[model samples]
Target chain A: MIAPLLHVTGLSKRFGGFVALNDVSLQVAPGERLGLIGPNGSGKSTLVNCMSGTLVNDRGRVQFDGRVLDGLPPHRRAYLGLARSFQLPRPFSSLSVRDNMRIPLLYTAAVRAGRQRAENEIRERTEELLRVVGLIDKADARPIDLTQVDMRKLELARAMAADPKLLIADEAMAGLSNAEVDDILGLLMRLNAQGISIILIEHIMKAVMAFSQRLVVLVSGNKIADGAPSEVIRNDHVVRAYLGQ
Target chain B: MTSATAVENPGRKVQAQIGTPMFAALATGVAVLFYVALALIGNEYLYFSGYVVLQFVVMATAWNILGGYCGYVNFGSAAFFAMGAYSTVCIYSIGTEYARSGVGKILGAIPPPVLVPLLIAFAGIIAGLVGLGMGYLTLRLRGVFFSIATLALSVVLQTLVVNWDFVGGSRGAYVIRPNEFPLLPGGFIAYLFVLMLLLVVVALTLARGIERSRLGFGFTAIRDDELAAEAAGVPTLRLKLIATTVSGALMGMAGASFPYYIGYLQPNSAFGLEYAVNAIAMPMVGGTQSWVGPLVGALLLGSFQQWATVTISSVLNLLIVGLVLIFFVIVAPNGIVGLVREWRRKRVLRKAVRP
Candidate 1:
């Protein structure tokens, strides 16, 4: 009965001659864990970019929280409660991990709160977020000092600092050990439990299967399947294109 | 997110250490230093040379705001500086003509205190707008392309100034120094030196304020990774424009007093290569990140250049600057401030290990 929190209709993107996303339509209800999986160059990140306003779609529209997001910048989208983590963990190298968390909190969440939050409150929130992500010990350390998994956690924490209604985490668990993957999966699940809707684009099938309640499959810029995770995984085309018979 | 106790943290400690009181104390200390220097220096030549060195401090500090903090390199420092210098010429001509008209004789009597600052403010605004225009045109071009555009902008501005007969053609224009100050103790040169000293303080304070503010955080975010900053809700284009305008305006403010100092300003002298190179090199040699780096760098390099000009040939001043800059870039790319921080960090590590 409720309208979808995020609704994408006929979304298409092109990079000159190559079509990256073609008429990809999808929807996510509030607080839903949506999995988006595609093989390399299958427009998984492209769709995330379009929805996040990093890249503008040539066709179709993205509707978030009942507003049509036609031509907004990434920061504007962030202000409207949309957030994303980069594939390569682009932490502010010069800043401490604490500062990294505080910046996004200040610019997005605090600005969205209309600067009503006190400095103490912001600092407390920053620390709380850091602690939740297990980066409390390394709060004063720079991004360069962080390990691969910590960098990923920091990236996710920075996204969390935005206090987004919808978070599209692009490949957050890539290149991590199985245990590290579980660590991130737990973090994402905790965030989801706190009522933040998430669209996770991941190559790690274990994480995708463990985290995604609803699954969507893309292949060469086309949406192949959209249904329950078990049903989508069992679909003939999805297995042929992605899961490999 | 889980509830956490309000514990003593390094982030809070660092923030507390550098709040309003610290900056206020720094300002007072600098003011006292200048006061003592003013009373001690009786030589006219020392005051004259001191003015130029302080001017560089202002320029370097301003340049670093955009170049160092925001990672936007500007090769058109001369253009902004010249805009200020030329603004002064235009204002001087207009004010002098107005004074000669008998009704404005009263206005001419109040020249030094009233007119100079007004003209300087006007110069700053004009240069700021120009900087905004330049940013609009070229800021979309990343790194080397943006720098090249600024280089081209300097040449274009120089050509326009050379042909503009109103202010001064290629020949030159003379700015007559005012005879006296009503409220101030310093005569003309002394007053100019004092004005420049005040300008240095203002520029440093402004730079420091920006370095500490939300805007400063936004700037570094853009500097580090623009896409990431944008996704984090920093408006990159707007921040870049602000940085460019503020940086350009302060450099223009420093240049506004140039005509009076030089007395005779030609196109080559006003839009010289030295202005562009020194503006960049000082900040680079000092460390681009913080306001202190540029201040320390400008003072060291500026005084050294002054000393070099006096001892060696004037031509060798630039050569020495070139050598120092090249050496610093290769050996200490982060500058003197970075070097000091590294040294201090090593000392702390050694102490920690032993203790």
Candidate 2:
């Protein structure tokens, strides 16, 4: 019942008259872990993009930490402690692993927080982020040299570099092994425990169920359910429209 | 395996690979030889041809900024170059007239030698500004559409220049007689070889700097995939504009020296498809993966073009470029130098593995 750290009211986005997200609304409390589940093409990414300021919504507003995020660009949003890890890990392939970690902190976190971390400080922080993602071994390696799991880890680590209050992880666990899913799930939980809110968008139900404190489902751009993970998973409409399928 | 491990830095390695002591000596030797030839020959034809090739190298290396590293194919390179060339001419033209009036003696007292870098800087800035404008207009389009839009912009700019008589549109404007410096390839050609040399250094340095920086990482990612880059906090539109603008400006600076070098400024020649082709070719021939490829491609192909035109003709130069381009695409899509380096690396790996 406490005030939500993030609030979305009457959110709507349309692509050339095709509604990608229609009247979608959800909220998350500070440091709460949330899972956003949906069928294929069910506005998950559109919603993420809208909130992250990658795309501007036509109607409604997203309020993060009490600031209206209607016109802010993604970097500015990141400066306000918003971060996102892509579905397909998109690290800077040409740069070394350490430099990839250096970007967000150098460009956003250090600048915004007015915490003038020195070169060695940034380097140490980059090393720490890489270590958390189990990628310290490939610290000097290029993204092109990384395997799929490593790329995903780099992507998550990159988002984490922003020192964000909320991390929108879109399909972070997709196309991973069973063990890899658990590994990512554990990371997300650890991140949540560190007072970082997460909106996990994934197809893997087990990881979602295991990680999410609150669950939300989207069916054809509409928010169908937003409540306790157990209650939302057992909802009849969700099963009929999404889960059973 | 150490060398087999993919290089964390892309363009730097290309530069490092080419920056060997022997290669640098050879390149430096060739450049000195060309300058010597131009200085001693005093032949108008040879100097003019040398000037043309030098200009082409400048343009090609400049164009590589966007087309090669950022993966945005800019066909409207001439717009900025022509703008650049014209700006310098206008500024020089105005300065000479101002010098003639009551202000002449007072201005003459100042160190006139400062004009060279001033003009070069002004030319680069003007072109960069033009590039900024064009980037804003055409950066939204990608692939062939982007190329076409930029080309169309060049055409529009060409027409605009053709109408503006102050910039010496179709009639061609001539600046006051330049100082008769004895630096081989008299007048503008000498100035241009020096300009070309400076540009090569600038392009190489800028390319290497960006390729190793955070901006460079963001750029390659955007080139790889836009949506994915955006999701990862790489600002796409802003980066593309900066790339295209800087790319445009460098070409513009290259263009800025053209009026003095050619001694005649015309819209058609300044804003031609030849510039477009040369720009695209340099990066491709050089191996767009690294900045060195463009310089290497420029030196090799540029020297070959110079030799061909002298031994054969200008048409033959085009034929060589066309053939070489086709050959590179088929035999080695990464370009000649890249292919050679790859071959050498594989050979080394194989040799080391022998038990």
Candidate 3:
């Protein structure tokens, strides 16, 4: 489909004889908001790990921007404009909010620039990223001082610091009030509108409905459906098994 | 650039650094002179206290590389110190024999005073290589697992040396002090304090650079959450290895100088739990989150233990360390530096409000 931005073919994985993913094939176009939804133990996280190069897939072709990514590490993938936020937000607790964002921004951005960006440039950009995530007021605060929502915002901000073209926000809005969830949903939408492709894996139906332009449903690590959000929700097995319709 | 701007106006912010460069410089100069004056006073009590305090500074600063910034507590630091001390012993003993050999005759032109630097460099290099090797293995494991593996390696190394008679086994080995000639009887107390001073500076520079650099933040990320660090694009494995290796090398340097200070080296002294505990306690009482924490911990707690050991007793020194550590953990978890920082911020805010 219009020369896939991220292409996966024959992706297979196992955890000591128990198959986690089996011959999964998928394609992601550039600047697409793709929602990957599934029930518990559906290997969503594992698939994400494989795609992000945290756990190497046993057999697969993970092609991003015409280059094969088989043995590259997660940081390398991040350097290549692929970033992800953890299901549980992880900010370096020892660093201030600004310093935490500065980590990826300095490393990846400097490398991409092919020369050391001045210290001032790094600081300015880090503050700008923090501002974008609405964490400027708490820039000097430690992660421990942050509420859960702020922690998640920091996580997203850290991912954004890499200036990724593709982002996988894994359960970013989990365990938030409806209003909080909507708040994060708006942030994700704003990021999406800025020409970044976002793959959101979440359980919140309201968010899944609101954010996704295309949806992929997984049941027990197998793709159950892949189509528009409206039509995919109409599938019989998806409704009875996953959608609870 | 923004850090400069941020510093230009602290703006009622608690995390503001007040004249950071000047503050740190004044602190370092004062600390160095304090130890130097104590050494010059030359009371046996001051000398004895001087010795313990200097070593504690080294051990704590060494351990901070891995434990404080990276958040990986290395219970195995004794191994690095032991390696350095034993290397010094081995080199001294072997050099003595060589002093009698055909090679020794040709080398007689080089004064024995120069040998101290030679032996130190050798021991540091050996320890650093060993550290690099140890890091390759232990750095793969994270958190508790990494600590356990390193702790086990420490035991393994101590056992290995205990059985090896070359550097004196469990019975231990003794070395003549540096510049032992009466004409050049080195003021070892002064030397040690100087060494500690320089090391603290080095460690501070390293810690500060890393704290502000990407690696510094990466270390914090790994400490905060390893999974998140990886997701956040930190090369976690590389960062941990670097921290461990640096930690090990510093421990080695400490060990190398130890033999002359104590006049004897034994496996227990070399690989004892006390050394590891002292290392941890120094940073713990200082506030590991910032570079200043370990420096403060090493200076304050380290000196107190030394003075206590001489004025009170050796066993009493351990008690003081234990009490202080417990007090810090239970009360000010952020340690003395954090407390001082809090106090300073409040004071600064009050000054700003004055009409």
Candidate 4:
């Protein structure tokens, strides 16, 4: 098998006495699509937070693209081609949507290119990303003016601006119509097709089943199952703990 | 894809871009015009009051670099200002001591024209280092916590200044003002006014330049949501530290001429609460979002305070600020700049719909 793009080992996080994630280890191969799902009060977000450097893990290590991401800040991780969208859309409200896209491009993509990107190049790239997310018309609009789904789209597009090798979308579709979920799923599929690995964390089963090649289940700070999507769903432990068989 | 073709560079069409150098030239032209007007008026009282107003322009602009751009409210304006004032005092005291000594007469002979600019630069460097140090210590605390720490910092610095005796301490220090300036017609007060006018030009140009650059975008991102900014690859801490240092340096430069202007430098006067309040209020009252806001706010409010001090009572200045601030908070929550933006946006919408 090819080497994994992301590897988390024995990751543990605690808030006071309560363990948020404990001994959680996982791997995603290059160009793989992995689904991370868990019940309420489970460690899914805690794990993402640790991996993204929003919150430090009490113990264990996170490796991404052949580099150890132990104490690196989130911006440093983005420099290394790891990017995540917040569970809630947190666009720079004061900025227009296109300007929002410019943040990651200016900071991460430009730095990665190792040369200054011309203003026209940055503007064109921004427009292209906004178009991909179907937000081209709303480029001049403020984030506050966008609909819920469009806000999510803007969030994803902003993350995509970094040209990340690995994208961890934390619940990119939470409260969406069936149509909106499919729209996001299609966007994610398009991004994945461009040689970008994706770890999709979602509660929506239909989208997850349709999107993830592999599935990982978390329950009460522990990974209960990790395997092919179909087999993982059929696992007795996952069914009992999460699928509610 | 068809819609992409339809849009056809919508962002470019909307943006009326001005290069930084062009903007700076225009701003300097406007400032030079104002300086000429003031010099032609040739009133020393006008220069004195104008110097106070222009000084606020620098302080308010400085405060906005961190407070308005990055959403970090620094309540230690007076502390930084006093740091600059005391730095000037230190230099002045040293010069006086050297003049009194037989062997060191040559060192004391350094002329005011050369000496004043050096003192301003020195004060800026000293205050900038202090700002960097303070930001490193306190930037981790967000929102109100950061503000509280800044307030505490001012108090601590004030106590330190009151106790330290070398630069006159609680007893205060005197800086003998030169009666004449060689180059200009209106003497030393006019020289101070001209220096402050140039400083305003520098501060405004710097503020406007930052507002349009990548650094400005990072600052706006931090102001909007710091967590998202960091995740988006913007270095929030470094950007914030830069803001603090720049902000502190400008405030220090504003104060560098204070001892010379006032002829007396007391800890209480230099570390006046008025400096801190006016610095914050000017930005908030004018609008914190753009470079234009602080300048507008400082000029309007600073001029009014000066007028009130002359026509009514000096004691009423703070009371007027409080009243005006409350009125603006209720009536124009986004400040004057925001109000203008909202109006302009509506007008555009109206025009678009008319066709």
True contacts kept of each: 0.67, 0.26, 0.65, 0.89
Candidates, DockQ: 0.51, 0.28, 0.56, 0.61
Whose TM-score is greatest here? 4
Considering lDDT, which of the candidate structures 1 and 3 is the better prediction for this target?
1
lDDT of 3 at B41: 65
* lDDT tens digits by residue: candidate 1, B294-341: 999999999998988888888888778889999999999999999998
> Residue A124 error for model 4, in Å?
1.3
Q: Pick the candidate with the highest lDDT.
A: 4
TM-score, structure 1 vs. true: 0.94
lDDT of 1 at A17: 98
Candidate 2 residues lying further than 4 Å off, grouped into runs, are A96-99, A112-123, A138-147, A243-245, B1-49, B91-117, B175-179, B182-192, B344-355
Q: In model 3, which residue pairs have backbone atoms overlapping below 3 Å? A: A120-B1, B85-B255, B210-B216
How well docked is model 2, in DockQ terms? Answer: 0.28
What CAPRI-style quality would you assign to candidate 3? medium
Considering every candidate listed, which one attains the maximal DockQ? Answer: 4
Candidate 1 Cα errors over 4 Å, as ranges: A243-245, B1-29, B96-110, B179-186
TM-score, one value per model = 0.94, 0.85, 0.89, 0.96
lDDT of each: 0.87, 0.77, 0.78, 0.91
**On residues A109-177, what C-alpha lDDT tens digit does candidate 3 reach at each position?**
556556555556767887888888888999888899999999999999988888888999999999999
For candidate 4, give the lDDT of residue B339: 95
Task: Compose the digit string of candidate 2's lDDT tens values, residues A116-158.
Answer: 4555577788889888889999988878998888899999998
Residue pairs in candidate 4 whose N, alpha carbon or C atoms collide under 3 angstroms: none
- Give the Å error, residue B23, model 1: 2.7
